[model samples]
Target: MEFRRPGPTPTPWSYWLIRLLFKFVLKIFYGTIVVENTHLIPEDGFPCIVCANHSNSLTDALLLVTSIPSKKRKMLRLTAKSTQFGKKTFTSWLIENAGTVPIQRKRDFEGQEVDNTEVMHHLMKALEVGDAVCLFPEGFSRYHPTIAPFKTGVARLVSDVLSKNRSHSDFKISILTCSITYMHRQHFRSDVLVTFHEPMVFTPKDNPELLKPVDYNVIRDLTAQMHQQISHGTLDSPSWGLVRTSKLAARIYAPLGTRMSLGDHVRVVRTFLDAFKTVRKKRDQSLVQQEDDQHNIDPSFISELETDLKAYQDQLEKCGIKDDRIRREILPRRTIIYRMILRLTWASFLLIISMPGLLLSLPVYVVTFYAVRNFKKTGPVFDTYDEIAQYKLIYGLISGVAVWVIGVLATLPFVLITSLLIPALMWMTLRWIEDAVSSFRSFTALGRLFLIGKDTLKEMYDQRKELHGRIMDMAIALDLPANPEEYFAQAGGKQKGRVQGLWESKAKYFSIRRRRKRDWNETLRLYDKVDYPDDDSEI
Candidate 1:
């Protein structure tokens, strides 16, 4: 089915303002937000139902609203819980104006009669106007690596629309499925990938009787199809442990000395997971396939790879080293020293200029930091890791705005100048902090060069190289692409890294790594045991 590419659509000033704020917040929150296949979003089509797997709470919706690029920004009428409405707060006002469609759930309002017929009408009205309507088919947000069971809301919407418009000769609608993947959800400044998959078209005008009633079976089947489409764009593993292991394997499998974009990282991880699933399925079912088959994989090879990876991880932890540090291009002692000095010098200069702003911004920064830090202690218990970031975002925004307003009023005589200068200073202060942290890490890594014995460093290097070469060989034997970065780049994906020259490589090596600084407790929390099977679990 062909979908007409969406052109500029008229959007309200309020929606655009909100979207602008969302874009700014997302940019600050995530180090990089890469959007892929934006062409698949039918922004100007007949009743478009956009569905996404709700994995990261409000952040998922915000990404959908702001990440995708379009010639004309189309306001996505989000379907939110009815409980979210009927409030006099800022959130309610924001959602109300942002074109949110509220659906009533009986569980939310106990002993009170709730109806969604009106909600359905509101959604239908919005769609009939050629507006894109987005809803999380999974119903609620989750931190699980896999998609949740769909709530049938999406299926019912599609079926109802198609059924209602069956008589119109030119009637049609498109369902755009999206998937959001986060490298590290709880941490700030991590990478996020938003993938918009091809749209599925439903044309009841050609065959009126082809439309089915929105019954249990029909909704279930449609939801399953939607789930499959969204799943295609996600990295689904049995548990977080498998996810981490797969990422580790991907890092080792990737070409040495090459930095991968998060998109490539996720794709490579999926490649490993796909191989694991295939090998495990064959082993569990006792399937006998010819060795010449392209899909055929050796179970022993995969087992050995996993075992070696675990050992490599243990070794790195024991050595207090990171995989990136080991695989990074080695530089001479003088070059390292110069680079360290340069970074430290730049950091010191930045800190001097940023001190005044940092002090002025200190109250807001410290309050937001400590508030979010002690949130779980004083606030309600968080259910998922995803909630942490969302809370931080909300707290930061509210506190920042509130504090800025108060500061401006207190210094009314210089309101105009201070208001403009304060925000810029705050921004400068944030950049300085990031640079300071990066410089500190570079300094530490450089200092370690002088402290570590040459023999021990060489041994660690040799072990890592051996493991990396073995993974490369196994990947080749399995007929996986040798260079994933190039493969993705060839497919029109953009990656950020230094080019192939000695000086350029050194510059890229010193570039700030976006990896989260994990303490011992954070590490333990991440690798906590989950009692799930190794096999792929159904969504």
Candidate 2:
């Protein structure tokens, strides 16, 4: 095979062709892809660098490419590992065609010294030609909730390019941070959020003169800013367990009947995590001051809160009940019956309409499912759980398109007609599957309400309330905002003024509710015929 060097700028035709293919693949793989702040990307042929957090391997790169609007998408050049291009494979061809810059690393090839001098020159040349280069500043992809430490490549490249070109009046460059978040990384047909933050612009006329040899402090500062921008747009939890706990706390604290978008849901989770961490820190500090012990919360209280929350979650799981349903489904018996009837009626109608599409697309579904499952057991081992979903997506698209092509060829007499009809059927099949899953969840919630009884349901609600109250207690003890949103907003600043009175009132209200609950329990005990001994006195 003859080797050809890619153009200084990306090839528009190849770039868009690959993008269109991946767009179709991603659309089917992810149930929803929410892109925020597209205006931040420079579109007027200005040199730009995009620093992004790497998580789900190719899925991250693909989603980022597809998320950008078509006007600027083709100009974006991606960076990939040098090892990817070493073999004569489809991946190498695809990356080369798409104009990916190969990055070299020493660890990738043990004992063999590696240098990125050529790679850096290629990136600088591309950016100088009025094209955007997307670099994963984390250096490599990993299944991490929080972003990894950023490499200095971004800083070095930017300073070098800008310092060299700063004499020209028209020279300019922008650095944009892209953050990607997945609702369920390994789950098929899950939702993803991609956000493009405001770019850090550098120009010839800027006051700060970064000379040929930029200071280490300057590079570190730039890296920190990039990290902060990327981290702000993601859920920066330390571990997956903390991420789960934060999400649960958000759901429990949110108002009933409130529908939050993925972006808003993420913000809510971040808020809970911030408040939780802050209060725990204060609790630790309070341990040293004996005089403050009366007012300060116990250091173990945080763990106790987490333990109780987990128990509540476990109980709900056992009962086949979701936390949101506890509030949404607690209704009068007649009202429940009415809602169930209406739900079943709508579901039946949907099922009847979707049957034809489902039947037509069954072959595509079965082939994709078995292929993915079998490949997981016998195919190349996946390093991260999220990587598996990307493979499933690619394989599913290949299978679906292959099936469509074969169908068209089989019916040669009506090739054009069959080609169009098959895709339409597949689309309808997807719509029906989504509707069916949603209806199933609703029906299950109703079933739980009927089978589990309202008394048990109310107990679950109380447990949620108790857990929420404990969180509020922690907030009050730390003199933080009672509302998680307020705490998150006022974070990293003095928070004593805004939420003090508000949290005090909230604390008093929950205290009264606790007293009422205790009184109700006492009344129930008095009504019992058998005399109960006081356990505290006997012990």
The models' CA-based lDDT, in order, is: 0.67, 0.66
lDDT score of residue 253 within candidate 2: 61
Q: Backbone collision count in every prediction?
A: 0, 0
lDDT of each residue in 387-456, candidate 2, tens digit only:
6666666667667778888889899999989899888866765655554555555666677688888788
Lowest summed-lDDT stretch of 10 residues in model 1?
519-528
Per-residue lDDT for 431 in model 2? 57
TM-scores, all candidates, are: 0.81, 0.78
> Which residue pairs show collisions in model 2?
none
Tens digit of lDDT per residue, candidate 1, span 1-539? 33343432357687888788878777776756778888667756457888888877777887888965645336777777777788987667777777777877776889999888888987876666677888898777766676778888777777777777666657677888987887676565656778888888877765343366445776677778889878767787556655666667776676432244556667777777766665656656775242425644567677667677777776665555557667765667788789889877876886788788777767766876786677646633324354677776666677778877987998899998989877777765665665566566566666676566566677778888998887777677767687754664454324432144477545643234322322101111222121223333212
Instruction: Give the lDDT of residue 454 in candidate 1.
Output: 66
